[model samples]
Target: MTTTELINQIRKKKSFLCIGLDVDLNKIPQHLLKEEDPIFAFNKAIIDATHHLCVAYKPNTAFYEAYGLKGWKALEKTIKYLNEKYPEIFTIADAKRGDIGNTSTMYAQAFFEDLAFDSVTVAPYMGKDSVEPFLAFKNKHTILLALTSNAGAFDFQTKTVEGKELYKQVLDTSKTWENAENLMYVVGATKAEYLAEIRNIIPDSFLLVPGVGAQGGNLQDVCKYGMSENVGLLINSSRGIIYASSGEDFAAAAASKAEALQKEMAVELG
Candidate 1:
């Protein structure tokens, strides 16, 4: 989806919430394990329950990858269901993929061409050549990792190089690449204080922020500093919403959690 389309969805739904489908067989309702494709079954229920409450859905690729070919097929089915049923809803492949130029091109084709995700999370440590191939795809977004939510982020992201924080340099350098207009960023909500500074560097770029909800990152604080005029935020909540229950009513429970976040997001957008 284009930036304008995304912003419009935020306005229409009064939400910037992106529900993360980080599904694990061990965490889902035990009954689902009997299904032919437990992962897709769980995802379908979650999507059905919460689709109206949020503007986006992100399925982290690793979850499916760990399960091998069967898992990949489940993910494919889940994504296809979302696209066909709710085409307006933004979809992200939280793949965090980055590699050499040729391999990155294949990865880009896999997600953007074959699977048809609206965006994919990419690691930028390999520099412009590795990420630019993903950017080459029309209308598809490359969400480059900037400041992450993990504790390990402090070990490098915040480290100064020539007196500028490393993440700031990433933000600055990424803008210089071709098709940079298709770029969004992964900025952790836990680092909310740095958002104002990050905004100054790229005032209009959208940020796909995780680390809210279960991560204890305050929603209001993220919106206060991270929000742009277009409501440039896709705040993600994975475990807190999707795993709200381990019972047969799991989908309904997930809906309730997503609804709570969406309600708060509506107020923030206003």
Candidate 2:
């Protein structure tokens, strides 16, 4: 989906929430285990129950990769279901993939062409050559890792390199790449205070922010600093919403959690 289309969905839904379909078989309702593809079953329920309250759904690739071929198949089914049923909803492959230039192109193809995800997360450690291949795709977004919410982010992202934080440098350097307009960024909600500085660099690029809810990042603080004129923030809540309950009412419980966030987002938009 294009940025315009994504923004339109946010306006129409009164939300910019991005539900993370980071399904864990162990945490899902035990009853779902009886199904042939429990992962997709769980994801389908969550998507069906909560799709209206959110604009995007992100399935972290690790969850699928863990189960091998079975898990991967479930992921395919989940994305196909979303594409066929809710074409308007933006989809993200939360696959933080980055490699050599040729390898990166194949990774881009797997997510963007074969799976048909609207966006995919990528690591920027390899520099422009690794990431430019993903950005080459028209209308498909390459969400580069910037200031992440993890505690380990301080190891490099915040460290000064050439008198500027590495995360800031990543934001600055990425803009010069071909088709850089299609780039979005991953900024942790925990680092809300830095968002003002981040915005000064990029000004208007969309940020796929995680670390809310279960990770204890404050929503109000993130919005205060990170929100752009177009509300360019996709606040993700994975465990808090999807794992709201471990019982048969899981889907409904997930919806309740999503509704609360959507309401909060609506207030922010207003």
User: Mind giving the per-residue lDDT tens digits that candidate 1 earns over 81-175?
Assistant: 99999999999999999999999999999999899999999999999999999999988999999999999999999999787999999999999
Q: Rate the local accuracy (lDDT) of all candidates.
A: 0.95, 0.96
Best by lDDT: 2
| True-structure Cα RMSD, model 2 | 0.5
lDDT of 2 by residue, 184-239 (tens): 99999988899999999998999999999888888899999999999999999999
Runs in model 2 deviating more than 4 A are none
Off by over 4 Å in 1: none
TM-score, candidate number 2: 0.99
Q: RMSD of each candidate?
A: 0.7, 0.5
